[model samples]
Target: MIKLRASRRGDGAALFDVWYRAIVGSHDFLKPDDLATIVEMVQRDYFPSTQFTVAVDDADRPVGFIEVDGDSIGALFVDPDMQGRGVARALIAATMPTDRAWTVEVNEANSRARRFYEQLGCVLVGRRETDDLGLHYPLLRLEHSAAAV
Candidate 1:
């Protein structure tokens, strides 16, 4: 069985490994150093342990995680081996709040992610260019409320 729980203090390094592997292992995303930097930043600042949920297997090993920044779904990742098993869905469902809308940026090149958000009633509001880390990526902002959409 799969269980969802809040992230723990000592789970930072393990979460980092999961985030790094999830990004770098994807042939379509970040390069080595970029993935490393992203993981580092998440571990140091963006993990949002207080507002994050980790998916654990029967053995209590984390298999996926989701981090929220305010109402925005900042990060969601599932271990490659555990993809398509409702891990991502459970994490997302657990993190969404009812009082406000949420937003997420999906890369245009990532069709699967775009479709996933769309299925969750997120609509593309606009596009923006992010020039962080010496790279420019076209990001699509998806919002979950009528006012935001």
Candidate 2:
């Protein structure tokens, strides 16, 4: 069974692997160079700098992660192998502390992700021409009610 745990100091590599695989599976719209750059950046900077709540299996190895970026879910990615198995839902429910709403961003090219979030009761709130890094991937901003996750 899967369960939740706090990410520890040595979790970056596994976390990075999770992020890379998930992105590769869902973000097929990204260019090879852009994806490579993102992979490098995530490994060299983001994963180490950011703290995440990890979802682990009985072995206690990470299978998914959620990043709580203030009032937003900065990131949420589950292992492609674990997709549609409730890992993402568990992360959202565990991280969201209130019955109010919080936002999540999905790449505009990633219709599958958009539908997944919508299935969790998220509604369209806005859009962005590029991601936070000024990348070319347009983003669809969505707001999720904590009550429904």
Candidate 3:
């Protein structure tokens, strides 16, 4: 079983591992040093107690995480080993507000993630390029009121 809970400061390193592994190991999106910096930024700017949820297994081990920024999902990652077990869906359902629209950015090349958002009723809004980071991504938006199913 998986449970969603608020993130704790102590979970920083574990969350970092999840983030690094998901982005680097799976997507090859960042270099080790850059991933390290991203993890540090997440720790400093968006720790568990601050608008983040962790998916903990029956053993009480964190296997995934989702971070919220305003009405947007800043980040969502599940341990590769835990994928396809409904952990991501559970985490999103637990963290997203029932009254507001939420937005997320997905890499155009990431078909799985795009499908995940679509499954949640998110639709393509526009395309975006992180000029500062030189990364191109697509924006998806979901309105809770309109997404009811």
Candidate 4:
């Protein structure tokens, strides 16, 4: 069975691998230099600071994770093999609060991610020309408002 649990310090390397694979597969619009820069930020800055809820398999290997800071989802990535198995949804649901709103920023070029967030009742609240990592990729800020629920 798949279960959700808090991420430990030892899980960083494995989570980085999963994140790399997910990004390489889904982020087709990223330039090589920009991708490298974002990778560094994810490794050095993003992962360390966020509160993560990891989706682990029966053997306790993480298949996906959600990086959240308060009510904002900084990132969500699933292993490429686990993409269609609801690992992302499980991770998000694990971290989501029933009475509060949560927000996420999806790459504008990633239609799949946009669709997923929209289906979860997230509305497009804003847009930016660059991602939070300072990469030049466009992003759509989405919000799941408590009042909208």
* Maximum-lDDT candidate: 2
Error of 3 at 25 (Å): 4.0
The residue-by-residue lDDT of candidate 3 on 1-149, one tens digit each, is: 88888888688778777776677655565556665666676667656446568998887788998888777787799988888899888888777777767777776657778887887777777666551246343433434334453
Q: If scored against the real structure, what TM-score would every candidate get? A: 0.81, 0.95, 0.77, 0.91
Task: Report the candidate with higher TM-score, 2 versus 4.
Answer: 2
* Cα lDDT tens digits for candidate 1, 23-108: 65553665566656766766777664445689999988888898888888877877888888999888877787655788988776
Cα RMSD of all models vs. native, in order, equals 3.1, 1.3, 3.1, 1.6
User: Candidate 4 on 32-143: residue-level lDDT in tens?
Assistant: 9888888888899877776688988999998899878789887799999998888887787778776888899888999999998898899999999987667778999999
Write model 2 residue lDDT over 101-144, tens digit each, in one string.
88899899999989988988889989999997799889999987
Ranking by lDDT: 2, 4, 1, 3
Candidate 3 structure lDDT: 0.72
> CA lDDT, every prediction?
0.76, 0.89, 0.72, 0.87
After superposition, candidate 3 runs with Cα above 4 Å error = 29-51, 131-145
Report the lDDT of model 1 for residue 37: 70
Q: Compute the lDDT of residue 94 as modeled in candidate 2.
A: 89
Evaluate residue 35 in candidate 3 and report its C-alpha lDDT on the 0 to 100 scale. Answer: 56
